[model samples]
Target: MASSDDAPRVFQPLPGRTVDRSAAYHALLRELLSLVGAEAPADDEPRWQDRARLAVRKAVKARTVQGPVPEEWFEPMMRATVHEPDPSFVGHLVVPAVAAWGLRPVLLALLDHLDNGTPADVAGVARAWYHTGGAPEAEHEASRDLYRRYQHTALRRFVTLDDLDARRCLLPGLRLQHRSFPPDMHELVDQAVHLARTSDDDYLRHRVEIQTRLT
Candidate 1:
């Protein structure tokens, strides 16, 4: 989400990019495998997280000591077929990208992250949303069709319902003009503008109106 006068709209098709497991993923798996008496962590201290994973280790360790499930249960639970058999997904979510996305709490998280994120990182957050929304390339210069695609409905709801400052600061900011969408597509925008005008988390009456009016 570069703030260039012209933001590049690079949409990846199915099998877009290979997933890279971050340190965070490793930390969680290490903790889980240790809890099941499967794989002891190679290090005494956590290789990644300090407080959060340590807390989880303590809790799960406490539960395991209580023996809620028998050791016999661990073998079959490890073989659960409900899970995907993809080699890429064997231990963690290492799937390649696709145009489609599930409406997950992560979407809400991106909106929440925009306000507090550093100036350097703000565009990254916005880019994540734009890509996750599957927003296609600009259809109209005057009105960037951010919400025209059916795939973008979840994104539309998120951007519209998000706080004015975040909407103004992050994705689809003042630089971009919002298209007037169909009632079905635009319903959330109306609600958000109404909420904004009514002083709900909107300090300026025209916080949202001003953006929509952009040429």
Candidate 2:
């Protein structure tokens, strides 16, 4: 019988080949997203609730693997579906963007697990990525907000004038003045602050500053 030591590694790092790893990571993410029926259509609107249900199903099945799947892998999808009344942002433009953002780290962690042939510590993987400058800091919250609003307006169904007003009030700059930031951005800023506090690296500190400034 093959011992644990004899088990093949799920992922092997190629020497001096960052692009190879990135390409592989994206491929695996697409595969997983497809597995959960989350592939977006190029010419049609996506069904966000369907995608969320599929993600929950996949995450549940993944638990049968040897170790824990990272919470980040599945939490956002589940959370997005937890809203009262409609649970789904079926036509909400923000849903897809937020889903993609939340899924990136989850996909990387999943890839690491597959490559390692073992359960992976996603937080450790995230720390490594941040330390290596793999994570891109958002340069401008205003730009992101504007883009999200534009997308929402363009894609949303049954959007009312009240909804537009609500969106305007939720813009980052406006919310900052009211001391009310979006939950996701608040969490990200908190994480960056925590990371900066724990690490002495100058670059990490600068990255944290850039992220926090946007928040």
Candidate 3:
């Protein structure tokens, strides 16, 4: 028998206001966790993996966050980060709220998803990390290494991945915001481009242009 309380817990948005997008996102999160072999943390569990959530919220303006942020909110945001956060999700989360608050969460979130097997999404994370001001020296000692990893490990891994969408999203970060690349970086780019060409899909040919300004 289904518990009467379970229905509301599954459908209700954190903070008690009903938001269609939030509700749908919560449902999708549970499904993804099942697929990934992870389980939802109980309310009594320690949901925060680190101080990143605190740093993100503390940076927010007083007007936006009224009081102590409900803990359930972190479940969705942290889960989103672990999945190597999508560009739209990053945009919605970072640009509107956290990015303006502080770039620390941006860097922390990028750190969490370095090995998720999608080159473009990783690059997008790196791009957002840098755009929001990568690794302030006072805060993080290994900031430069993040960019190095993006070039050497994350973006370069595209050649080994078969995700067409990752390939499509690759061009934007590659073309924009790149100040330096390792000597063999072009070789990897050529290989990825070659793979895209062989597929002969127009969407595979898509190139995301650099934004002139943050939206």
- Angstrom error of the Cα, residue 12, model 2: value is 20
How much does candidate 1 score in TM-score? Answer: 0.29
Against the reference, the lDDT scores of all candidates come to 0.36, 0.30, 0.41
What digit string (tens of lDDT, one per residue) describes model 1 on residues 42-71?
455554333333433344445555645344
Clash tally for model 2: 2
Best by lDDT: 3
C-alpha RMSD by candidate, in order? 14.7, 20.6, 14.5
> On residues 7-74, what C-alpha lDDT tens digit does candidate 3 reach at each position?
00111101111112333444545543443334454435464212232333333333245555433344
The residue-level lDDT of candidate 3 at 208 comes to: 25
At residue 115, give the lDDT of candidate 1. Answer: 43
Model 1 lDDT, full chain set: 0.36
Q: How well is each residue in 21-96 modelled by candidate 2, as lDDT tens digits?
A: 3333334344445544454333243754344444544444444253554445453332222211121221132223
Write the number of the candidate with greater lDDT, choosing between 1 and 3: 3
Residue 199 C-alpha lDDT in model 2: 52
Better of 2 and 3 by TM-score: 3
Superposed by TM-score, candidate 1 places the C-alpha of residue 60 at a distance from the truth, in angstroms, of 34
Task: Count steric clashes of candidate 3.
Answer: 0
